[model samples]
Target: MGKVRKHSDSESDDGEIEFKKPRPAKKKKVETKTAEKSNDNTRDAKGDAIFALSNKRRVTVRAFPNGEPAIDIRETYVVNGEQRPGKGICLPLVQWKKLVELLPDIEEAITALPKKK
Candidate 1:
């Protein structure tokens, strides 16, 4: 039979049920290698598909399980000298292009908003 889970009451007569330990989850590999960026914006400390928005925030392009590259604009914190992703949005190519196309309108909308001190 396939793997079975026996209740404690059922296993009491048969000594005990030995269960295999669960394996640890595989870790996702992260790279921050340098490469030429098309944008005029100079490369940050972590170059290539990543650009720094500030000391703690940056934008990165990476592919998910589906192999489609998405732009992740997220906050990061250092862990053993590596930048780890934090809360952020991952925009697919289509949405990213739409955002680019709406830059003018977005700017105008921002301009219409009341100023805050």
Candidate 2:
């Protein structure tokens, strides 16, 4: 005759399941040397581009009376937008042609001028 089985429903006789510990996150690589050099180069490039554009011809820039960019370019001042006068600074008519020749992205550059006073 086979042995009879017993059943109990009080609590788990076996131990609880165990989980593996999570690994630590990896740190990002730093490029301090390369980053520092690139910063100065970037600024120099921007300054050169602006200087080249302005040196071709003297284009005067003025501050708007209402503290916004002016709409029309004055004979003496280079009015750009209605909100700020100097904000729309550009090369003279003759120099504009040259500027466009030097930088095809002149339109984008001018449009991206700062709006803040």
Candidate 3:
């Protein structure tokens, strides 16, 4: 039998020298001017609110995707003389329906609570 040959770092198992081809660097994502213009227009076209409850807190119900309803419940406050939108819960149509169904029980629970002094 022939003697076994040792392989070098740059050599393949068959003793052929290997050269690695340089790969192109990945390109970063850049937002185009057209994309920015579309986003600006979408921001300007705010959805119309169908129902609103305004007390100490403000809650609004608006239709999204033309027909589906969404409820946004948030606090009303002012900062630097400008009214700023408060962070709050947003319920989609299904969850909003569930909340409506549970309203009777919720009212009962609230009525059962002791009155504040």
Candidate 4:
């Protein structure tokens, strides 16, 4: 707790009456480990930004040595202590962006589809 000082300094405080105790100085903004963000982009040693879908699957932003950049949505497996990409599709950045933009429409379309028996 802090001491409540008198409003004797109100004349110099732009006509505002102040009777409350002095507050502590502000600290730097510190982000927590579990802070939620729209996108969580992290990179691996191979220079690929990996977004893990599961223990065995991930979506990665990759740039090939041929100068082609792509978004890889793939499953992975550990072989001899190294993670290897499994059967999945790689979309060009342009196509990936388009897909992201269409997600809302896709959801609506999914709801409109007939249920299978």
Candidate 5:
């Protein structure tokens, strides 16, 4: 049996010690100035706007239970071109606004009427 030779540390394809340095990481692409500006503008616009309810009777503004801002409105009553008196029904603000916008001038004139004791 011949002597068992141990593997040498310094060995290469051409039998030379090779020391390899790690390659640098690749850099990410940067967004353009106009793109960044547009992004900022969108963020600002989003921040300024909110889902809110504005109606003739009453306006209620708050965030939804799911964390989204929402508006709830109460509808007004009308009786012979006069606004009826009492608590109104609740509806989404957008719907209420659209209803009023679509309603005739006589209907729009009706607001939260005075309550009689």
Candidate 6:
């Protein structure tokens, strides 16, 4: 004779039971030394190019993760005998372009201001 079993609430009337196993957590990727070094090299090269210019400032146009265009403006300065970065500003690409287009008018307005004694 075959063995008989009592049915639980989770078991179907047809005598079949469903089981589910818990999934394992995903692991985060670790950055390699070579990748870090390459990033540093790229940063150094960009810094050199910015400082090599007479303006000592650079504007980088990039896209955000959400697909919005952005402009980053950074300036280099000498602080305590070492080259350091100054305060930076970030704006939308449209605003940056508008600012560029209005540069001549802005300069004229600035020059029109009365000089301080």
- Give the worst 10-residue stretch by lDDT in candidate 3: 35-44
Candidate numbers, best TM-score first, in rank order: 4, 1, 3, 6, 5, 2
Off by over 4 Å in 1: 1-48
Residue 98, candidate 1: C-alpha displacement in angstroms: 1.0
Where model 5 places Cα greater than 4 Å from the true spot, the runs are: 1-57, 67-70, 73-88, 105-117
Tell me the number of clashing residue pairs for each predicted model.
0, 8, 0, 0, 0, 0
lDDT of each: 0.73, 0.37, 0.59, 0.73, 0.44, 0.58
Which tens-of-lDDT digit does each residue in 47-90 have in candidate 2? 22111123222223323455442222222222231111233353
Kindly list the per-residue Cα lDDT of model 1 for residues 1-117, writing each as its tens digit. Answer: 234455565535654455766777897665433334566754444443777889788888777669887888998876754666799999998999999999999999999999999
Off by over 4 Å in 3: 1-47, 50-52, 63-68, 115-117
Model 5 lDDT tens row, 46-107:
24222213333543444566665455444444444443324644445576677677788646
- Model 4: per-residue Cα lDDT over 25-105, one tens digit each: 997544323212345566676656778798778888888668789999988876555677899999987898899999999
State the local distance difference test value for candidate 5: 0.44
RMSD of each: 13.3, 20.4, 16.0, 13.4, 22.0, 17.3
Cα TM-score of candidate 6: 0.40
The TM-score between candidate 2 and the true structure equals 0.21
Task: Please give the distance, in angstroms, between residue 31's alpha carbon in candidate 3 and its true position after superposition.
Answer: 36
On a 0 to 100 scale, what is the lDDT of residue 111 in model 6? 100
Candidate 3 lDDT score relative to the true structure: 0.59
Worst ten in a row by lDDT for model 4 = 29-38
Lowest-sum lDDT 10-residue window in model 2 = 43-52
Query: In model 3, which residue pairs have backbone atoms overlapping below 3 Å?
Result: none
